[model samples]
Target chain A: MTLIVWTYIVYIALSVPLTVWVAHTLHQNGRVFLIDSFHHNEQLADSVNHLLVVGFYLINIGYVALALKEGIAPADLRQVLETISRKIGVVMLVLGAMHFFNIFLFSRMRRRALLQRVPPPVPPQAHVPVATQ
Target chain B: MNHLYVLFDAQCELCVRCRNWLAKQPTFVPLSFIALQSTKAERRFPGIDALKPSEQLLVISNEGSVYRGAHAWIMCLWALQNYREYAQRLAHPILLPFARIVCELLSRNRFFLSRALFKQEAQSVARLLAAHCRPPQTLCSNSRASV
Candidate 1:
């Protein structure tokens, strides 16, 4: 393999992990993301979103550089395009599946937190004790 | 039954309030909220030393070992998530050790963080509970049949 080819391979390798990390980080801090998207806590969530996007670009740009170096096609451009299309399709499907799973997980946590949380006891004055006199 | 059982200061109005909130959750199963401060608690389960009972300890009861602290909460959080299978794995024999370590660290800090806010909160809860719960008990003739 040529030096450029090795560099390209390295790029792909680097890209995969970075992609995974960005997704994980985005997920780890996802409450903020959902809150922002829902307009509940837009500023804080968007700020984190922006930070993730920055990190995403840095890593994916590296991936594109690697993809560009693949040089001559595999004899059939259509075949190559088809293969690329298939992989992207799978990637998107996986992303969607994972997102829903996270959402499910998140909703459950919120429920538990809600369950575990006690509303402050109502003040005694709110409900008059029936006259015992 | 969940792998993580948060042994809390049930004597705390805030803690009790949180438990009440957890009790109202619409999950397939309810999270177990134990009041470690109750004398009944000592008689009911593991003994908690009085000096630090209020400090609150979250115990993750699993296959064989118990996890406390931050790791316990993390594992509990994992269980609280909908991926029940994955969460189960977290408590499995292989992963238990790692989760336990993480649970301990986090729990250690969480108590102090919520102490002040919850302290005042609990006072209000206790008063409300006193006003409501006592009346019901007092009126019920203290009879099992009546209750």
Candidate 2:
């Protein structure tokens, strides 16, 4: 039981720093560079990050509250580790997938912007305007 | 007539939207919009290959000189005399390199964002959105140009 609790604690500890770093990157980039697309106040970004952490905490805590028994034993330790690892890994993968999907959608926009600049048709000499006249 | 021409891809929703916004800006400068996709762009500026900026924003000044990519953005900034001080500050010799770094980073994100969320078109609406003209900002105060 102690080991299971510790594993959960280690996961949370590692993710907290990583979450802050990701939020910082998002806050800085969302402003100046992608100006025309979307922007948010810096304060808002900070708030959102805080909110995300809170949400994460609530979910994980709730999960542990229900799943963690007072006496997890040495005999059952191997299965416990595997279960906890899979759950955490799946959560991380889901988060990563969401971000990747978002990025992929934006790249499609760039491609359309590129296509918008294409020429309508080739102009023939006669149909073209006579500059001097 | 002093003409500012923005050559852009018409197929891109983001580009079209940006052009529309810029056209409505109250600069009083006459602008001629050409979808580079239209032969009209080439017909207007002969001897130039139309395909070059068909995928990028091309700004052509009244002087008939063309600017592409970031330089094109610079010309637009030059025209914003009301915001000149901020523009200058952002493009300052000391600050410019950092600004470019920021610009490049933003552009990458923009490209990604457009491809991911909107899914409508490939035109990334990446912008260095200007700080608004206001008395609180130093740039607006420095502007002698008519607001």
Candidate 3:
């Protein structure tokens, strides 16, 4: 009915779809990376992929809900659009940050697993006769 | 490598204590410890002294490659399941010189550290381990700080 209420409506409408779209994109594309990180364990990778998407939805949607009432009361239609734009911009940034954080976490896990195959960094000084134990 | 032989100076209480601790850790490659001049060490590597095992740590891979001092310490950690990443990080060119300095400092001052940290029966046992090894030195000959 009021401008602020209309702003909330528009913000939610924009944010929920953006969240779903980002989650779907990440879930589908991140599966390949997760599979590789998990060393080709598709079952495990899919499980993790689903879990990550669920968490991403929860955090982003919760943030959107919490941040809904943050800005000053909108006086006019122009002000309403401005508030909605600001709110959605913050949500997009948060999503981008979360995406980068997830990539960092998974890459660290993959690096640790891959370290098992890495050769010794330093070479030996000499050679000794192998003694039969 | 499948196995490693670590040669350490038995007379140093700190080294002996470290050997026992290393033996208990879970490792990717099994570790076998040998006192530098023990009968078994002499029999296994007749020219062990040429490598100067007493001055620093020595690790002999099952394939016969010998790693000395700081490199030997890194090899030991690399063989461990938990510390392999740490060893790799330490082996990075940026951190490697620091690792070498730390290892050399620890090796040179190990006896002093042992006297300060360990006064238990462990020192006596270590003394009995190698009769020919360097006699245990007094801690901080200049400083009067009580350990």
Candidate No. with top DockQ: 3
DockQ of each: 0.02, 0.01, 0.43
Over the stretch A1-133, how does candidate 3's per-residue lDDT look in tens digits? Answer: 8788888899999999999999898898888888887888999999998999899999999999999894578887788878888989999999999888877877876776677677887898898786676
Candidates 2 and 3, the one with greater DockQ:
3
lDDT of 1 by residue, B15-127 (tens): 55555655564443335655553333333343344324444355434221333443444344444434334445665667767765654543454444346655445355345
Models sorted by TM-score, best on top = 3, 2, 1
Off by over 4 Å in 2: A1-133, B98-112, B121-147
Least accurate 10 contiguous residues by lDDT in model 1 chain A: A120-129
Residue B85 in model 1: shift from native, Å? 9.4
User: What are the models' TM-scores?
Assistant: 0.32, 0.37, 0.72
Q: State how far residue B53 of model 3 sits from its true place (Å).
A: 3.6
Which candidate comes out best when scored by lDDT?
3
